[model samples]
Target chain A: MIDAKHLTKTYGTKTAVDDLTFTVRPGQVTGFLGPNGAGKSTTMRMILGLDAPTSGTVTVAGQPYRDHPRPLQVVGALLEARAIHTSRTAYHHLLALATTHGIGAERVRQVLEQVGLTEVASKRAGGFSLGMGQRLGIATALLADPETLILDEPVNGLDPEGIRWIRDLLKGFAAEGRTVLVSSHLMSEMAVTAEHVLVLGRGRLLADLPMSELLAQAASDVVLVRTPGADELGKALAGIGATVSRTDVDALEVTGPSAGRIGDLARDLGISIHGLVPKQVSLEEAFMDMTRDDVEFHASAGSAA
Target chain B: MSALETQAGATVPAPRAAPAGPAGPARLAVRSHPVSTRRVLLSEWVKFRSLRSTAWTLLAAVVLMIGIGWLAGWGSNDSWAELSPQEQATFSPVDITLAGYYLAQLAVSVLGVLLVTGEYATGMVRATFAAVPRRLPVLWAKAALFAGVTFTLMLLAALLSFVGGQQLLGEHSATLGEAGSVRGIVGVACYLTVVGVLAVALGFLIRSTAGGVATMCGLLLVLPTLGLLLPSSWQEHVLPYLPSNAGAAFFSAAPSADSLSATAGAAVLGGWLLVTGVAAAVTLTRRDV
Candidate 1:
């Protein structure tokens, strides 16, 4: 378990993480979601004690990470993909890290095989592709079989198989009762992998709840009605306390009302409906809405669309 | 104590048995073991040999030291034969074995600078400090490793160079018991190792590979050059205090015309090492990696 209380890190006049308070529980994959510069990386760094908090405390399990006995065993982290010397082979890098904890070389080989890096274990890590580097990073994170694993952008450059492999791996780790806090900007991946989300925008917590709650809190139960009298149907739906928006010249999205209700309203108004169907907001759309104000760099088209 | 919070839609696997103890969150004990200096030393040694750079540099220092001395002694036979009485009186056969100290110090200094500076360059300092957060232990371990390696290699290099250079000297070899001769040759090895570590401490304080290497070389080579151009009063006051200047005393039995006493030079070198080590520790512990 990781608990960050009022975690604030400021660099000069820019606040990277602003009074961020959240708890990452064990036996789950908690996704740390944010757009660029939303303090996701900074938060992870502070959790690992790589960066000192300006005026707050973050602890892994109970005590600070640096204070933990056998830190690698307690909280293994892969903050950077290549947080290793390029000259060292993957085998030696894992060996050196394992040596600190008195973890034997067998564990190193096991992790290498787990990550499908056994064949290339003797090769220099500098020659690894971005996907291979991610695997190595995961290998390092799993070196001590750490209880609390913190991986930042673990799937940034992976292929489809690599992505699936990581998803399954994190799931397996969390299933083993390990606390897994993974930070990534890939919402699609997060949708499929994250059990909970700690959403951030402009360095402040926008939402911290179950993914279900976030998706549910978003405008839901959307009904699409296509009719010759779309404007009339929208007016009729609005009068019935449903929020309506024009999606197209002949189509209107009606929320807070089921398709049955919208169809009933259209039938009562004697408007022949070509289509009436319920629409569920995609996780991508719900994520966008949740982080609308929090996104650091809001591209005009993405926001406007 | 462990809470498993799962997002909607994303299927979370059930919690498996904890690796060691309970099924829920496992809190770390508040108590911590006292930091062991020996463990830190062992860790530093592991880090030192794990890198190819360290191995190659150590090899270069020994090989270059012995190789250069052998060549200088062997190649200078004609010059030694033709020397006038004045030159002959000043030229000691043992002195020829110390010729490689100049080149060996450069290799050792480069190696020393890289030892500390490489951490900063590769951003491994974060991982290092995370593993050993007290900070001082890390620096201390590294210092011990650098000093130990350089000293051992220098001692070996001195022995090899002396043997090789003596072979070139043929019948002109100086005996090991000769006054000041034996001390000078062994002193060169020990002295160069000390300077190498002094360079490492400087590297730690600077934390930039190029800057550390440049500053070390500048102190050893550049400042002495500029000092030579200075007036007698300034040169005498400043030159003896520089690390290389003070360190040069270890290479000689006869004192320079206006050099510091050997004891004073040793003290000066120790002072530089202390200052650099302290300053590096302060910055390392205080700064966020």
Candidate 2:
């Protein structure tokens, strides 16, 4: 488990991660979600003790990451920035890190195989493509078989196949009872993989909820009606606390009411409908629906937004 | 993709293997071992040896040392006939054997600085600090490993240069058994090694290649040249105390009256290194990556 209590990091006049308090539990994959410049990397760095937090603390498994007997063994982190010397071969790079915790060369080879990097184990990392580099980073993270895993955008540069592989690997690691915290800006992928999500907006915790609850929150029935006289129909059907938005010149979208009610209201109003279709809210829309209010809330409070 | 063929779950993947439960794999220990100093030292050594830059840089240092020493010896012997009796009398074979340091120190110092600052340039410092969160052990291990490697290689180079240059000098050659000959060879190695360690310290303190190298030059090279602008009395008192000059005193068999003694030279260099080392440790520990 990883616990961060009031973690804050400020750079000069800017606060990167401000008052972030959350606990990432074990035996599940916890997704760290945020927009660009939301301080996901800064928070992860503080967790690993690379960057000192301006205030508060982060601890993995009860103590600070630095206090662990074998830090890598306790938590393995794949930070966003590449932390490697380009000149060294992939194998030697892992070996160098492994040796630090008294881990042997044998473990290095195994991780190389696990990450599908054994083919280029002896090649200089400088020549590796972005996908290959991500694999190498993942291999480095798993070298010690740490109990907790923190990955930042682990699929950022991976190909379709590689992305699928990492998705499974993370799931498998979490299944084995490791604390897995992976950060990403995309909500679609997290909808498929994450059990619980901790979302941030402007360095503050916006949402900490289970994935099912998040999806259900965004699952209210919203129907679309395509008609030429959208203003009259919108005015007629928008009563009773329902919201009607004109998506196109002739299309009006209705929410906060059932499709049958909207059809009956449209029929009673004598508004001939060319198309009345129920729209399924996608994960991406759900994400935008959830964060749009959070963003507006910040904008209304802070002048900088 | 093969990975997508067996879908575990829409929200969370199912367990592909049995629960790890602290007995994950054979390689993973049930309880973790502490990060010992010995392992950190080993890690540092592995890092030092893994790079091709290490090999090339060391080769450059050796080449410069042997080439300069031989060239200096050869040029002196070739011009002996044209020199006056006074000029010939002042020529010291031991000095000629150690003359390579003027160029060799540059290569050694650059490598030392790169050993630390390269991590910052490549973003590897995060990985390093994460592995050893205490941080100081890493700095110590790197400095120790670098200094030890430099000293060993430089000592061998100095000895080779002396033996080879002496053979070329013929009648003007000084044997290892001769007075000050062995001391000069060893002293040159010590001076170069200390310069390297000092460069590593400066690298950590500065944390940038351009800044580290510029500061090193300002201290070791430019400071000595700037000293010439002072009065002769002050120059004698001050120039010999500069890092490069003080180190030179340790190897100069025929020292000028104003120059410091060998022991004093070592002490001054030691003092400088000690201050820089502490400053480096402090800056590294306190600063954010």
Best by DockQ: 2
What digit string (tens of lDDT, one per residue) describes model 2 on residues A146-264?
A: 88988999889776667777777778778777799999989988988799999887688888999889888777578888987798889887667788899999998898778788778
* Model 1 local distance difference test score: 0.78
Candidate that scores best on TM-score: 2
Candidate 2 residue-wise lDDT, B1-289, digit = tens = 1332111111212113322333455434433358988899999888889999989999999999998999888888778798899878778898897799888898888899999998888878888888889899988988889889988999999999999998888888889999989999999999898889898998898888888888877887789889999999789878988988888778888776677888999899899899999999998888987
Candidate 1 chain A: worst-modelled 10 consecutive residues by lDDT: A296-305
In candidate 2, how many Å is residue A121 off?
0.4
lDDT of each: 0.78, 0.83
Report the TM-score for the A-chain of model 2. 0.89
TM-score of each: 0.88, 0.91
Per-residue C-alpha lDDT of model 1 across residues A197-304, encoded as one tens digit per residue: 999888999889987777676546878888999988888888989898998999998879888878787889899999988786777787788778777776787663
Task: RMSD for all candidates, in order, please.
Answer: 6.3, 5.0
Task: For candidate 1, report its TM-score.
Answer: 0.88
Reported per model, the fraction of native interface contacts reproduced equals 0.19, 0.49
Maximum-lDDT candidate: 2
- List runs of model 2 lying over 4 Å from the truth: A227-232, A238-241, A245-250, A267-274, A289-305, B1-32
